[model samples]
Target: MAVSYSFVAFFNSISSSYSSSFSKPSLGSLKPHYGLRVDSKNSSRRLVLSCSSSHMDSNSDTMDIGQTQVSSTAPFGLTMSEANMSRSSCKWQRVLLKVSGEALAGDRAQNIDPKVTMSIAREVAAVTRLGIEVAIVVGGGNIFRGSSWAGSSGLDRSSADYIGMLATVMNAIFLQATMESIGIPTRVQTAFRMSEVAEPYIRRRAVRHLEKGRVVIFAAGTGNPFFTTDTAAALRCAEINAEVVLKATNVDGVFDDDPRTNPNARLLDTLTYQEVTSKDLSVMDMTAITLCQENNIPVVVFNLSNPGNISRAIKGERVGTLIGGTRNSMAART
Candidate 1:
């Protein structure tokens, strides 16, 4: 069925009035927030569910958690649940997805690609349907790169980064809207207080959201300057106790050389944390890589060109580069 005319409006209610507006929703909370049905005009069965959000006003047409209907047209070869069940060998049940702003940019030189965002939302919905908890840390390079302005605009590096963090908030909300459009339960939590737009980062509360099968998008970086979203992703992953981190980028996987510039660069199936650190592979910032290594959390680097790749990566497909852990610092090379 085609998605509805959009259901929720999060800005302000979620982030602005968090202190007074936010309340923890029980996993089986039955507080009914009126929901909509999206399916064939004549479909007999319709789903109704309860959705919880901070400062949900007296509006009937708002975000709600309902049994999602699988589109007859699957994103890949199978439906969301089928794709998930197909991955009985999946190593991690809960994972943190790190998405670069550029990944959502598609062929354009700038701005968020609606197509890419919706595709990602669909794939995420698929994973959640499988009952695998999912959280995300999205970057802001597409809207504005903090460093780009810091160096060129003569702005303080600290303030420039704050701007970049705000950019991420924009990205986060956009993603939230897209996901909700498709009936996926979702929330946006931020490192800093953007009370009008996102909930301030609360570790336990964030975990609760995921436990309820809601996709939590962590935004605003670490709420500190001089830190990339990668660091934020690592930090959130550890706090949430995720099994692994899925680093989605433009490239299909980790390559020996810059695939865009060097044709000889070979796709690496796997590598150790020590190998990435020792060789200084450009997969992630050294700090982010070290954090994951110290926590023993494996990283899966994959391309987000299509919706299926995200689940395929989580399903243990050898789609992208799998960075190794401490137990084995020496594994597949290229």
Candidate 2:
């Protein structure tokens, strides 16, 4: 019995979730903001190269490693207020959700706080039930950061990055378990091949999964070293042609300064892609932001702490900072 129990625990730790793009808006209606900085042509070319190599290569969760497939229709039971009755009527049909690993860590010393994971799972669950196709790209900072790990250890950067990629796979497995437990049908696809744990990420296959209303989780980072998960999120967003990339962070929204340290920091409700790149906001890496700019895909940076904020953003209720092209461009689309 003890051996059997140990085997179950081992399976639960790693083999949990096995699961699971961008449209361009017109540029003519772009509303120029006060300050605009163009992304360097060099950076643009670099991004294109990074994405191109990925066509040559590729691109989470849980303890729920049970053999039984969870039912997708299980009641997530997210209450929508009458004020937000059209919550299901999202502005975009599909989106890529970028969740940081630190957010999943919560207050724990070890990686992954179960409560936070569950909360996020429920948020995704609610969105899936609302009929918006949800695809997720999760980071592994809570468990391991390749750069940091390399800095701390004497290991080479490339080796550390490979280990970090594995950490992302672990996170994907854990999330899969948590989401499945909530009755959401989740699929985990990896940039690197992990035949036993997840499906190899095929762009068309990922899109089909989204169309079928399955929440697809993207793990591993570009199947190559020296690439951050933010880049992975941006790449996946473009590949799948998602309407937007919703980056869920701990703080409420983008601010002039670090909200944690500066009492005077003010939340920004909206920002242009050019402004973000020019100002070098901590929202995401330059590569990720540049890709969004190139594709004209809006990114909503919001607080995952607030329950139901995902639904709010999707419903266009304005809960976080909306980053995209000129206001005129956005307005024309609406």
Q: Which lDDT tens digits does candidate 2 get at residues 1-334? A: 3468888886555323210011222334333222212223432322221121112223311122224454434234534342134343567678899988888888766699888889988888767776778999999999889899786647989999999889889998999999999888899999989999999999999999988779999999788898899989999999999988888888888999987899999988789988898998988989889888898888888888888887776666677789983232233211
TM-score of each: 0.72, 0.71
Candidate 1: tens digits of C-alpha lDDT, residues 1-334:
7644443345434334432322433444334443333323433554333244444555534322345544653333466567556445465788999999999788875599999999999889777766678999999999899988996657889989999999999999999999999988889999889788889999999999987778999999999999999999999999999988999999888888888899988998889998898888999999999998899889989889955888877766666888873222332222
Off by over 4 Å in 2: 1-88, 325-334
Kindly give the stretch of ten consecutive residues in candidate 2 with the minimal lDDT sum.
17-26
Evaluated against the true structure, the overall lDDT of model 2 is 0.77
lDDT of each: 0.80, 0.77
